[model samples]
Target: MKPKFITISDSIIKKIKSGELIPGDKIPSENELIKNYKISNTTARKTLLEIESKGWVRRIKGKGTFVLNRTATHQLVRTLGSIDSTRKGFNESLKAEGLTPKNIILEKTILNEGVSAAIVGRHVIIEGPVLKVHQLRYADDELMKDETRYISLTLCPKIDALSTEISYFKAYEQQYNLKINDIRQTLSADILEANSNKNHFGTTSNIAIFVLDSAVFADDGKVIEIEYSYYRGDKYKFAISAHPEYGHKSDD
Candidate 1:
């Protein structure tokens, strides 16, 4: 049998999906849940927390839990570390959620002056000049991601000459004959003030943000690019499937 908390959370989710529990609707209080479902207080609290973590409701201090504008606060989920998935999965997730996804190149430049052998074994795995491309990504017209890519010109000569709409991965495969092997990445969370120095998102401030630092490598064990992407926490979420080999063991 499924865990009681999961069952309760799923029931609430079903109500929300059916439009019975909608935006701004206060969900049942912990006491109400305990009374209605005959569950313990701990289970009731877990149920509510699970729902909140799923981005379905907001709990105001002493005011009960209420629904949110899912369209605005809806979390676009992207699967991470999936061998079968690519950056294309991100756009696909947005479209599946009834959102329109787009990206604009904020800047693209060459970094010849700073090309040095020292950075090869460190930040970048490639040994020559780099092309930096800064972008702002949007979903449903809301600022979602501020991304910057540093590509190895050594691996992709004249890549900067390509159109802004070209997919770098496709270019690697077709133009450079380099197949992507794996991407090493690290994800962390932080808060960004509305007046961030970058000013990437004008409408939101003091919001949660996710920082993704990654290196893209090719089949030959050479790094193709390095990237730093900041994703709006309210606009996105990440999912990953892991077997025992990759899963983190619980301390408990």
Candidate 2:
């Protein structure tokens, strides 16, 4: 049989999972736990400690124990068409939830042919150089994703001079009048240690992340851009769909 303290902790956790106890709400005090669960003071203290260790609740010196605001899941629907579809979807979803979407340019540089080929793919030939731009994306002021996009300067010349504040896809469509044909993408998940580069995400070490890699093609069947993106796993969920008529198997 499980210990009384373990049972008590589990019950509290159920309340949290059911949304009966929300973040910032104070949990049962030691005395209250002892009276309610008929457990000893030692058991009550142990239960609180166990909960705190699990990152569910935090105890303040004089303010009592309060539930931590756990991560909420945001769903991302993948669309097969358009160049800026994903970006536009993200912005719209956040706005629908009353959250403001923002992006910060972290770094921008020109990569030589060798480095560009190695990063993107050998099949993607770079005539001259590639412009790589790194960005941090946020929702409601909380960092949500990190992205690195490589653009072929041969295709979008003077792209480095464009403002990072605007969407690259929109800029490509409006300024250059380029039509995007398709985007091939892959998704994976991994745990990343908190490094200086990830500090803006406000996450600790060993955080789970969702990775997305995509190659955008122009109307002429030329690869124009490659993008690598990392999203906080705790904050986002993705749904993928396939159309059999489009040569995509539903089982895929």
Candidate 3:
């Protein structure tokens, strides 16, 4: 036997599938649902929460819940130097509906010096005094994460003068005539308020999340930016693709 709330949710899902419910449409109010379905207020609220956790709708405080149209907006491509990537499983949810992703830049800044790399043999010529930029990206106003990047001053001399109105990629392309090519990435897990990120995000303490450190390269095989990003573990995930080498046998 199933719960009454699930039955109600199923009805709503069917409505969406049948075009009776449209994307971005506000769901029927709790009061209306109670009146029509003869369900309790608790049951209605719980059903909405479950739907939200399943990524079917977004609930905004002081605003009503909205049905999502996951589509092209959620598909994240896997590639090198791709600053525009999304966490795992989210793209699928987005594609399920029909929405295009929009990334907004929250902030940018400059720094005095640059940092060093851990790779051997790549150290000597890899050193350069750099410019640092900090940005908080979002998908349609929802907070995604904060990214701090160190850029080579040799390629972009006036990195400090970039306007807050544009994204770094846009600035680099339009202003400095630079395009990204390859990237090397490493990921690890950590808690909030532990190190440099704590000072940046300005949080007391929160759940654990993934820290992404990437070295971005330009089309000319030159290293351009080294970025460190922190994502909310509960909200984001990563995707990977595997390709076996030639003449390799399966371990299984």
Candidate 4:
């Protein structure tokens, strides 16, 4: 049997979903919940805490709990280099959500010195000459993602000449006739902070964000590209799947 607090919490969540409870609408107070369900005051408080932790509601001192505002799930699980390596990933995700996706080229330069040289030395197959590109992604004109990519000039020299809207994966396969072997990434939750794009993203009040670091490999087991992306936590909820039986397999 489920815990009494969980059962009560489900009941409250049902009300929120059915529109019986709405955002900014006060839910039952702890005392009221105790009276309504014949549960103890402790059980009632536990129920409230459970729902709040799940992002269903918020508690204001002396003001009771109120349903939290929510929107459609904008879950992004893939990258520009899709698992299958054939799809236009980031754009497709936005279109599926009924939002127009736009990308802006903030900067694209040949990296020969400074920190770019260090990054190139560590990841790119070539000893030097990396093409670094900075891009901003938008959902219906709202800035939603910030991306920086580094490409080995020795691997795909045309990468620097491609249009801003072109997909790097397409260039790798179609233009260069090279097959992608795998894509690896690491994701973590973080806060948006002072950076070069702070003006584009505005204040750090909405601090919740996700940082993703990725590397793309070629068929010959050479690392050709590296990427860093930041997704707005307030706007996106990501869903990732794990297959333990697969046991550390790369996307084929």
List RMSD in Å for every model shown. 12.2, 14.4, 12.5, 13.7
lDDT to native, each model = 0.71, 0.69, 0.58, 0.68
> Tens-digit lDDT track for model 4 on 1-252?
999999999988999888666444568888898899999999998999999998888776664676665655443334322443223456544553345789998889987641322232234443357888888998778778888888887888767888766767777878888767766666678866555344357654546778777777777777677777788777764434343222223432
**How well is each residue in 29-63 modelled by candidate 2, as lDDT tens digits?**
99999898888999999999988888788777775
lDDT per residue as tens, model 1, 46-96:
999999899888777766776655764756555556433444334543443
Model 3: residues >4 Å from true position, as ranges? 1-109, 119-128, 138-142, 193-205, 241-252
User: Each prediction's TM-score against the native?
Assistant: 0.61, 0.58, 0.48, 0.58
lDDT of 3 by residue, 1-252 (tens): 989888888888777667555455567778878888888999988778767777777775665676776543332223222244321122222332334343445445554455656322244123466776666654554545666777778888877675533455555666788765544666678877545545444455656767777665567777777777877665554543233121112110
List the candidates ranked by lDDT, beginning with the highest.
1, 2, 4, 3
- Distance from true location, Cα of 131 in model 2, Å: 1.4
List candidate 2 stretches off by more than 4 Å: 1-84, 87-93, 114-123, 195-200, 243-252
Poorest stretch of ten by lDDT in candidate 4: 114-123
Q: Which residue segments of model 1 deviate by more than 4 Å?
A: 1-72, 87-97, 113-123, 243-252
Poorly placed runs, candidate 4 (over 4 Å): 1-82, 113-126, 194-199, 204-206, 241-252
Worst 10 residues of 3 by lDDT: 243-252
Model 4, CA-based lDDT: 0.68
